[model samples]
Target chain A: MVTYVAIGLLAILASIKAFHYYYQIKRAPSQKQLSKLVLSTLRRGQSDRE
Target chain B: MIKKIAVTLKPYNRVPFVYQKLKICRNCRHFTVLGERDCMSCGKTGGLQPVEKRAAGIVRRDQWLTGLILLLLIVIGLLFSASALQTVLLIAAGAAAAALLWTLSKRFTPALRRIQLQKMFQQYSYELASGLAIDHQAAIRVFQEGDKPRTYEMLREIGSLVHNDQLKLEQIMLLQTFQLRKDMDLMLEPLLMDSFSPDLVAYIGEMAKIRRDLIKENTFRYMLQHEMYILNMPNGETVLAAVAGAAVRKSRYMTMYPYLLIRYARLLPKDRFLRLYKFAKSARSGPLYDEVMRIYEEKFKWDPDFQNA
Candidate 1:
């Protein structure tokens, strides 16, 4: 019974880690996308001035 | 006889200015301008120079005293360790003595010296920030005469008072003196975040946006959010309304707006993007207004529902 309980806990921990990695992957691109948007805005500004 | 008289008169004329300059030094509570080389007042040789008061001598003396006290405590601790009770008592006494010495140094010497040093630096920084040429000798005196902490505090205070673009531009030239960009950013952060003063915020935002630092993205995001919030609110003052209306009309957030609009449009079945589009269309035309309209038309080609209206 104790062994079974330990196995369950390990499974839960593994799932949590997997979920965390997925969340990080999802959030990382949003920050990059925001930066890209700002860069593009700056480029557009330069082009307009020219 | 005339040449001799002229020389004597010249010497007499210069004596008043010299005396006037040294009057404060002579009357200083710490002054000891005895005939001997050493100053009897502060116990240092040649310490009473014909200049303004400085704290460098006090700093050196305090450092020496702290070091000596620490050495004495270490020796005392080593001698008393054979008896555990005596060792404990000796340790406690040493700690108390150190604390007392620290308090005395803080209250009597370094604290007062730091206040004087900070005042001197503040005056120098204010003059520099105001676009006036700083006296290099006075600046060097401040740097050489004050402790590091006192100098840093004075710089921070002076930097915080800088509100004009010219002053900010001048102050930013001194960024090299600070260890981290965040220290300078902290001094600028409040001015940038001021909600009621859009022009100040815009100026700070422009400066931050130009810098290839983390502050650029952070400040832009803050400005964008602030503009959006001001626009969404119904009852805003003229300045807030003008800034928001200008920002929206100009489409300052054009690149990011489509992504946000698409998401918001998806959440609202009534199509909120159309409302924003109409609002932008009706808003007065400016440089930003034209840009905003171009982005909306290019990104979202929603059929005009007003054709039947």
Candidate 2:
């Protein structure tokens, strides 16, 4: 009886974890913006060196 | 004469997209939060521009990567489970749990972004301090892109390390563009001058007017010691009035501004004179106060209520 209860609790926890990732990817801005951010940082670094 | 460097610099080159989502309507001047296509107030679409970032933040990559890896691990764990109805149900539950963890972790995104921006700023500050020259353009870009308080903090950091007058003048020029806080003014107190370039003096004068609370007593003393030549520029009187007002509020030593007050006593505006009058009246009666009072009386005819007392 105890073992069955433990298994049920574990299952519930895993479901919660998977749903969290889905939300993050959904909320994230487009890949293009992310790439732009990276490019700008690189450009700034180069300019600072010069 | 401090000449303006004519560099055709793009103001928004280093600004990120997330920072540009908000705009002010040109037609109505209403602040629009989300819709960029049309002004929510007047429906004028063309005049919208990115004005300011509402929050200090950056995209937190590490947390995102961690959540992804955790989800991937859960998927692999479920794939190895046996093919029974109970096993399938357990796998479904596992997926759900992983999803919750991932999404809940994202709630930390804003907090993480703040921390990351701070860390990045600190690193950059150290770099600027150790370098041979002050990077005015880089500082301007940071001021434009970073959070308001942090930008001032970075300025303070750079300001402390900078010793050259030309660089100091540049820093002051950069500083004037922002709406500065009192604490930032305090940080810039060490840069106060008995004499400076007319342009720099004008800039400092503007700062004194806008952020009066930030000026230290020593700055007032510096002003008192310097000859009146510093105030001969276009906005010199405005600067003097600002300094006098700030000195009245900040100077604890009673004897400090007496000479200045006496010299410029009659020239002071009614409000400023009243402020000085009130401060002098409240202070302990000493020879210095008496002398100051004598000077005030010399400038303006007034009968004191406390003369009989």
Candidate 3:
């Protein structure tokens, strides 16, 4: 019974990870997001020097 | 005649986003935008991979882990199966789930990679910023060592990420030392400043004379806003005329910046005036049309080229 229960839990966790992966793929970043990444990181670099 | 120093400058590697040039150490995960070999932080050789490749590697690892979990569950279920029927059912279910996941990942590979890249950047923003800062310091140290050309090259690489007025000005000041040659790789748009500086205007004028094609709307606009200060310079009219000549290269410029021609039409060299004359002949009567026509009459009335035009 304990072995069966562990199998069930692992199966459920795998499905959950798959679901998260699907959403991550679906909501992939746009051009604006990449541009923001560039601006934000550059801004951080400037502040760091000061 | 003005002399120009000729030097071969390596063309900059172009990218849609500057971050694309970054390489991260797979070992220490330290990021750097410099050369793609050897982790500068850990001194480990051959441990660096391009950021996108690193992101894709992470995606593949996650995918493998998920698949392995499903496989492990099926094996555990089969080991404790009460009947042959239970064993078959567990195998079929696990196989189906693995197939579905493999197909999904294969189809969404590009999207998965892009999403992973965004995540990687967010998670490692601090490391990436520090890496770039270190690159900047290294460049400054080179400058201190009095290798002006080498220092400029280093700054140019770092400028891909660290774009601010100070960096732009430093490049301009260094450029002022070297005689700018038309054949050398020079960039104007990246170095354009938000505010006015005499050094910048002089550079613009220099570019206008040699690389007229680099003179675009931003440059025209810059010159227009600071026309008074430019006029105060001994050769200001000459600079303005050279810029006007660049405008004549495109009909779009003639239509877009008539005011520029109106003010400096007479100062334009003969060839530029001929082009403006041809444009003026087609005008339906804006201030630009009138100015070009008046200049044509006043300056080129008896010239053979004007008569043919």
Each model's number of backbone clashes? 3, 25, 0
TM-score of model number 3, chain B: 0.90
**lDDT string, candidate 1, B13-116, tens digits:** 12222111221122222321112344443345454443224444545565576557455554645554555665555555555555554554454443344433
In order, what fnat does every candidate score? 0.00, 0.10, 0.39
On DockQ, the leading prediction is 3
Per-residue alpha-carbon lDDT of model 3 for B1-309, expressed as tens digits? 334444566677788877788888888777887774888778789988998888788889988888787777777887788877677667766777777778878888778888878888888888787877777777789889977777777778777777788888998887777778888788888888888777888888889888998989988888888889888888888888888888998999988898898888888899988988888888858888888878777878899988887
TM-score for chain A in each prediction: 0.54, 0.52, 0.60
Ranking by TM-score: 3, 2, 1
Supply the global lDDT for candidate 2.
0.50
**Model 2: per-residue Cα lDDT over B174-290, one tens digit each:** 555555444433334646654555655666576666676656676666665554766667667667666666666644633566665555555566566666676777775755457
RMSD of every candidate to native, in Å, equals 25.1, 12.8, 2.7
Number of the top-ranking candidate, with lDDT as the measure = 3
Q: Weakest 10 consecutive residues, lDDT, candidate 3 chain B?
A: B1-10
- Cα miss at B151, model 1 (Å)? 20
